[model samples]
Target: MTGVVGPGAVWLVLRATVLVVVAALLQVTVAADLEVLDGRPDLVVIAVASIAILQGPSAGAVAGFAGGFLVDSLGLGVIGSTSLTLVAVAYGVGVFGEGLRRTAAVRPLLAIGAASLAAGAGQLTLALLVGSVPQASPALALAIVPGAMLDVLLAIGLYPAVRLLLRRRGPRTVSLDLGAARV
Candidate 1:
């Protein structure tokens, strides 16, 4: 199976798996309470969504599922909530790639904003749906905004690196001319 797998497919799987693990570790260790303006930056989701959008719907969906699952497992948030939100955001971003690719600056900003909003809304909706209306804390919301903004900032900084990495891992196509002279 490994021998049969295309280089690009293998790279994507390996990259996605590594990213999920790193993101989970970041969420558990470095990201804890590292607040900016009271917001907790969600780098994992933003990175996952940004990459997914750059790739395609299928890639984005896979990344989203993995990222969300990692987030749920590492964070104290509800299960499946982040997963659902990430999947939706990844698909949405992937669908907009054409337009986004046209405007390079817009992509990161949009990815950050969309991922942040989706994550916040997802958590809120999950809480409500589960009949556990944890008292909405204004302080918590305030903290989250800054964190989300930080995530956006991080996305801006990291997009190029991610693109380069993906490109390096992508499949290469070789072209041959049938009518050319043979040595």
Candidate 2:
């Protein structure tokens, strides 16, 4: 409303871009390679989900696409596959948030955990669909919880920073149904 594109939206997108890119770089250079508790924390997934929780489905999907593309490009993976998985994860989480009347501080935690699990599962499923047998084993199932927990921990800090960056004087994000969390 104020500019060709509202300054708020531009700031939000810029912040998201920085967060996604930085997190992906960290994931590629550090986090993804570092094993903790038998699994790695998905920095890009956490970052995208953190921003999506604030930005809504469309923005979330965009962040997801960027983060996923970074992973696909920076690491050994098929293009568009990780992108598709993260898009679904971001979109689903944003839609779920849209139905809520309010959110507690715990909401971000829950959302991050769910998104992490979903991201992991989505990646696995898409890989399988593409004929990539990713060495499935019993340990893989157990890693889900650890990975999600680690992601939630990372998101605890990441979400607040993203929310702050995206914050505007009034409501800036458009929810799917014009509803938003009271938090």
Candidate 3:
């Protein structure tokens, strides 16, 4: 984790840890109760995507794993389920950002929106593979859109906050006009 960013390892880890923890708590306690077209906003995916955008794929993967573990342990569902889904979310967002990260505001919104669908699909696929298939219906497909919209709305606000929090602090480099300096 530290190697990915270079320097201020403690600061980065602490910030990521806090972000993940809060998101998990919010997901389980708050987000779980809220619904959007029969789906709830995925705060976990939002947090993971936000970090992945700032730190890249490796960091995002690590954060996803950690956050997933926390959520799983909280006894929401099958072990490693959320973790796996979030890992995919983090990696997908990170990879997406790798190519077009410079677009700023739009990138994070789209990344989170896309990854939200990926997370739901991944979870459903995994659940089916494990023989614990959740109820399927047309609502399931429709739910992804609102869930994605919620994620986008959340990411629109969250990505910037996370970026600001994890921003590297250092002396600003000044380009001086010393080209004509006398020896």
Candidate 4:
């Protein structure tokens, strides 16, 4: 038990630390716009949500808070907005992912849709609170749908790869036959 717990604890801490650092770096260096469209990929948000889905809601929430706080600290937008958005996104991904996991084909698509919805809704809510809703043609709400769809598409392309890497390297259990191993 001690062996299991100790290693698991270490792995968890290490994983969380790495996730935070990577997310922060991505947020700081990567331009949100992807050139494919006039927008950038929300890699930080997606990372947080993916971690949460893979780890569970609590881990996701923690990752979300850390990632969002970092994003806010960068002065991209009002503080707490990203935090709130990420927490919600993480939770939704964790919950919905359970159901979607049953069908292999649907998991990626579901992740994409859920991730986009969470990010767009969070951003829209922030815009409303900050009173800077984009008001030109189609209105801000209309943009949310398309923006979220784009996010989903991006997630579909990226989530599978991330998932595969995470799963492949995840902690494993090994047994050694000590008595029979004497050479």
**C-alpha lDDT score of every prediction, in listed order:** 0.70, 0.78, 0.81, 0.65
Q: Can you tell me which runs of candidate 2 are displaced by over 4 Å? A: 1-5, 100-103, 134-136, 169-183
lDDT of 2 by residue, 127-182 (tens): 66677866776676666888898888877777777777666645567546546644
C-alpha RMSD (angstroms) for model 4: 4.8
Tens-digit lDDT string for candidate 4 (1-183): 111244456666566667666766776676454444544556676677666666667767777878888888874667788888888888777766555553255565667566766687767777766777754344655655655666567667566655653442445677777896843
- Model 2 residue 45 CA deviation (Å) reads 0.7
Sort by lDDT, best first: what order? 3, 2, 1, 4
Residue 89 Cα positional deviation in candidate 3, in Å, after optimal superposition: 2.4
For lDDT, candidate 1 versus 2, the one ahead is 2
TM-score head-to-head 2 vs 3, winner: 3
On residues 112-172, what C-alpha lDDT tens digit does candidate 3 reach at each position? 8888888878877787778786666676667677888888887878878888887777667
lDDT winner: 3
Task: Give the clashing pairs for model 2.
Answer: none
| Model 1 lDDT tens row, 40-159 | 777777677766766776677778888888778777667777788888877777777636763387666766676777777666667666867767667644545666677777777676
TM-score of each: 0.78, 0.82, 0.87, 0.73
RMSD to truth, every model: 4.4, 7.9, 2.5, 4.8
Candidate 3 residue-wise lDDT at 117: 87
**lDDT (C-alpha) at residue 168 in model 2:** 60
Clashing pairs in 3: none
The ten-residue window of minimal lDDT in model 3 covers: 1-10
